[model samples]
Target: RLERLGARFEAASPLGNGQCSAPHPLTVTALADGVALEPAATLNCRAAEALARWTTEVQVAAQKEFGESLKSLALGGTYVCRGQNHDTDAKLSEHSFANAIDVMAYGFTKRASLKVTAAPDGTPEAAFLASARTGACTFFRTVLGPGSDAAHGNHLHLDLRERNAGHRLCQ
Candidate 1:
C-alpha cells in the first residue's frame, strides 16, 4: 500500500526485545511524491505513513507561505534504541520502537534551508515553522518542537503512539 502511494522504503528485520523493541520496521528513503528526506530515516509503517502525509500536505502550504517549495527534510535520525533524550536509565522513547521521527530542518528548492530553532525572535521562517508544527498534530499523536522542551529545542519530534480517547500531545 505504501509503495503504491509513492513511498520508497524497505522492510527491516525486527529488532530488540523486552522494554526496547521495534516491530514491523521500515527504512524509508524518500517520498516519491516530491519530498526527499536527507540521510533518509527508519520508522514503523504507521509512522512512515503519517510522515509522508504530513510532508506532502505541508509542502503545498509551505510553498504558498514561503514562496518556495520544500525539496528535502533534514532529519536528526530515527529508530534509535534508546531512552528519551538518550537517558539510559529513563524509559524508552517512541524512537526506540520506530514510532517517531525527528525533523531538524527543511530544505527548499529556491532558498537556503530553514533551521528549526527558537532563536531569531520573529520572522516569516519562524511563522512557517510554527504553522508546520501545529499542522503536524493532525497526523501525529505526539508533536514536540522548539518550545516544548530543551531536549526538543532544535527539532520537531513526531510520533504515532496510540492513546485512549484519541488523546494527542501537541507541544
Candidate 2:
C-alpha cells in the first residue's frame, strides 16, 4: 500500500533485541501522498504505513479546516535503541524495535508550521493539532501528545504496540 502511494523507502537489516527485532525494517525518506519529513526516518513497515496514513488524513483535515495543505512533517526521531524515557533500567520503548515515531510539528503550504506544544489553548492551530491527535488514535496502538506526560510534552508519540484484547492507548 505504501509503495503504491509513492512512498520512498528501503528495507533495512534486522536490529538488536533479546525479545524481538524488526525483521522488516524500513527507512522512509519521502511519502507519495505529498507529505514530507523533516529528517528521513527508519521504522518498521507497519509503523511507516500507519504514519503515512495518519499524515494523509491529517493533511486533508487541515486543508478543510484551516485551508492549508501540509508541506512537511517535523519529526523528532525514530528507530532509537533506547528504553522508555531513555532509562536504561526501564522497559524498552517501541522505538527500540522500530515501531514508533515522534512528530514535532506540521509545516503548512500557506503559513508557518504548527508546533506541538503543551499550551494549546484555544486557537485554529490548536484545534488542528487536537484533531490530528484524536484522529491518530484510529491508526496507532498508542498516541501520546501534549497532555500525555512531561516526557512527551513537545511531540506526538505514536507507536504500534501490541496490547491485550486489542486494547489501545490513545492519550
Candidate 3:
C-alpha cells in the first residue's frame, strides 16, 4: 500500500537508546507520486504512512493553489533521540521513537519553494500552507506549525502521539 502511494524506502537498522527506540525503522526517500524528501527521513512504519497520506493531500493543494506539482520536501529532522522541544528535562519526543517529522519547507515544480513560516495573510502561499496544515490533522494525531509556539515557529511538527479518548492536537 505504501509503495503504491509512491513512497520509496528501504529497511533501516533498528534505532534505540535506553530512553527511546524504534525496533523496525525505514529510510523514506520519497512520498506520494515522486515528491522527494530532501535528505530523506528515518521513520517507523506508522509515521511514514501518515506522512505519505498527508503528502498526497498537499500535492493536490499545490495544484489547486499554484497550478504546479510539488517537487520536494525540506525536512528538518525525523528520528532523533531528544526530549520534547529539545529540553532534556521534558518528556521524550515522538522523534525519539521515529514517530515524528519536522517539515521545514515545500518545493514545487515551477513556483518558488514555500517555507513553513508565517506568510502574508492573503497570499496564495499562506492559503496553501493553511490547507496543508489542516489536512495533516486527518492523518496525524498531532500537528503543530507556525504560531503554535516558540519551539514550532519555523516548521510543521507532525506526529502520531496517541492521547486519551482519541484526542487530536492541531495547533
Clashes of each: 0, 0, 0
Q: What is the C-alpha RMSD of each candidate to the true structure, in Å?
A: 1.7, 1.6, 0.7
lDDT of each residue in 1-100, candidate 3, tens digit only: 7798789999999888988999999999999778999989999999999999999999999999999999999999999999999999999999999999
**Candidate achieving higher lDDT, 2 or 3:** 3
lDDT of 2 at 161: 93
lDDT per residue as tens, model 2, 1-171: 888866888888887767546778888987855678889888998899998888878987788778978878889978888889888899899998899999999888889888888544787877788889998999999999888889999999999999999999999
lDDT of each: 0.85, 0.86, 0.95
| lDDT (tens digit, per residue) of candidate 1 on 77-139 | 788888888898997899989899999998888888888887454777767887889889999
Name the best candidate (by lDDT). Answer: 3
TM-score of 2: 0.93
Evaluate candidate 2 by giving its C-alpha RMSD to the native, one decimal. 1.6
| Candidate 3 off by > 4 Å | none
lDDT of model 2 at residue 33? 59
Candidate 2 lDDT at 63 equals 87
Distance from true position, residue 115, model 3, in Å?
0.4
* C-alpha positional error of residue 10 in candidate 2 after TM-score superposition, expressed in Å: 1.6
Error of 1 at 146 (Å): 0.9
Q: In what order do the candidates fall by lDDT, top score first?
A: 3, 2, 1
